[model samples]
Target: MPLNRTTHRPVSTNALGGLYVLGALLALGVVWFAEHWLKLAPCELCLWERRPWWVLLGIGIVTIVLPKRYARFGVFLGLLCLMTSIGLAVLHAGVEHKFWPSPAPECRAPAFHGGSFKDWMSAMPARPNKPCDSPDYLFGLPVSMTELGGLYAAAVFVVALVGSFRMGRSRR
Candidate 1:
């Protein structure tokens, strides 16, 4: 027997939101794992890349709780958030590749303020300092992690946008 569209619409809509949430969470988990388990530190641009994922996750949560009529809008917002992330990742990757200079001054190491050597050492940030121009490889791949993240964000954006449109049409 074939599945009825009427019966399947809610399930499919909810599934889209759930999948987006899961993807965002997984991306964040990988970043965290790289920082803690692998002992890799994130640069300023790398930290910037995380903001859109958090926004996407919030959008996914809103999509899940919204009324059926508003769910498509939520999904559309997620697509926009993912696109923003892709842009940031691409910029980060470009900085790493030396295509252009980094827009953020924090890409360079922090300068010491006027003080004794011990005072400067004590004032230094605890986090490991990795410059934005340096690339962190993944599994022997030539591309940096930021580049891979941009690819992943692009894929998710396409999926969410297509799914949102399809779900909207199905409701008519």
Candidate 2:
């Protein structure tokens, strides 16, 4: 199913922006659930994988507080977030699969690793990469990190695309 802001409401003004927000919340909740409830012990790779969802969530928030006219732009932002999430997740999955390499330089990249000692300290758990991109949890059949990442990305995409219904109007 395509991501929509919220499909439950009447499909006219497409004010059902809740879906986008919910999508972002869901993504955040997944991370939280995995860490606290599921005890997934996110590796640096897992944290990296979540960045895009976080971005999408941010856009969702703006969509909520801003004008309805901004909903379409929010949708576009959501799409960007999803695509980025998908790309990152794919790369993360590759790292997990050893399709390329682990301990991605992002953990230490000049591009990403540029930060203070506290930032580095906070990021330490994620550093050096987790021992094989293994999911800390197994739902039914040995759940994969890649699967979760893709799931969030797909949700973000849906929210963003659906936001399109509210496009091109400035709040009157």
Candidate 3:
């Protein structure tokens, strides 16, 4: 029920911060569901793309806890983390679409020579190692997870930026 001093409109920085926290949780939840329930194996680049969201969640939590005077700092941190997530998503999508090669060494497939069955089994990892170029679609959609992530991040960034601007103007 906080009123914006400049616009005389009701606004709450905590609400905006909650958007970030919930959005990050939702994203992570979807990925987890896909991995565990759907049995989707994430490639190295895909895993890398998740790092920013984890950080963003912490930023959101801090933003919600901080005083109104310091909330802007937390918002800025969330923005930075979202931007980093978008960048990683773009990189991953590009690799999936063959726009560029993945920079992660783990993305490459291991060369296996002819060996005994026991040796082969021992050499293989317990979980399947997916290649970065292989795309994982959600619900049979044509869009790759990376592309979806990038779009989601961009959307969140736009909303957060606008909300922060509206709230910040009252402080000036």
Candidate 4:
């Protein structure tokens, strides 16, 4: 059997699964950093697309903490998150393409910058249009919403897949 670098246990499957969560988090961090630190304001749909990610991040942390016996369940959870993010990314891409206007009312219009208690209490800014649909291209392909969304989803799926292999080991 292979030797474990840390605990010296045979590198149990559950530990590997935990690492999967960790890796996925790191990947997400990069995306987060790019968005927040770089001041790249996401469109309403982009923010909405991130909802599953927020949820999955929570689940990923919990999955790491839970008993190893539930590792398979965690894998499934990851898969669900992966699928959700992918779909949203596609929707964002669609919005960028103008194939269909963003269903979000916010994206349909502008924000309200009134200077009054009543104005502040009034209807807020309708979501503004997406600033970027194809800001940059990678390998001759535009870094449009759909493409990036698909890539992020694929990464999450891979991590979950790797995690899955480790799940069965602990249930034994």
Overall lDDT per candidate, in order of appearance: 0.84, 0.63, 0.86, 0.62
If ranked by lDDT, best first, what sequence of candidates would result?
A: 3, 1, 2, 4
User: Per-residue alpha-carbon lDDT of model 4 for 103-164, expressed as tens digits?
Assistant: 77766544667588778656655443455443423346647534676686777577666556
Model 2: worst 10 consecutive residues (lDDT sum): 7-16
Better of 1 and 3 by TM-score: 3
Using all chains and alpha carbons, the TM-scores for the candidates as numbered come to 0.82, 0.66, 0.84, 0.65
Prediction 4 global C-alpha lDDT = 0.62
Question: lDDT tens digits, residues 63-106, model 1?
Answer: 88888778778877888888899999989988988999999877
**Candidate 2 vs candidate 4: which has greater lDDT?**
2
Q: Where does candidate 2 stray beyond 4 Å? A: 1-16, 106-129, 162-172
lDDT of 3: 0.86
Query: In candidate 2, residue 26 scores what lDDT?
Result: 77
Backbone clash total, candidate 3: 0
**What TM-score does model 1 achieve against the real structure?**
0.82
Candidate 2: lDDT of 21? 62
Candidate 4 to truth, TM: 0.65
Model number with the top TM-score: 3
Best-performing candidate as measured by lDDT: 3
Query: Per-residue lDDT of 89-119 in model 2, one digit per residue for the tens?
Result: 7777776676776655544434335889887
By TM-score, the candidates rank as: 3, 1, 2, 4
Lowest-sum lDDT 10-residue window in model 4: 7-16
Supply every candidate's count of residue pairs whose N, Cα or C atoms clash at under 3 angstroms: 0, 4, 0, 4
List all candidate RMSDs to the true structure. Answer: 4.4, 8.8, 4.6, 7.0
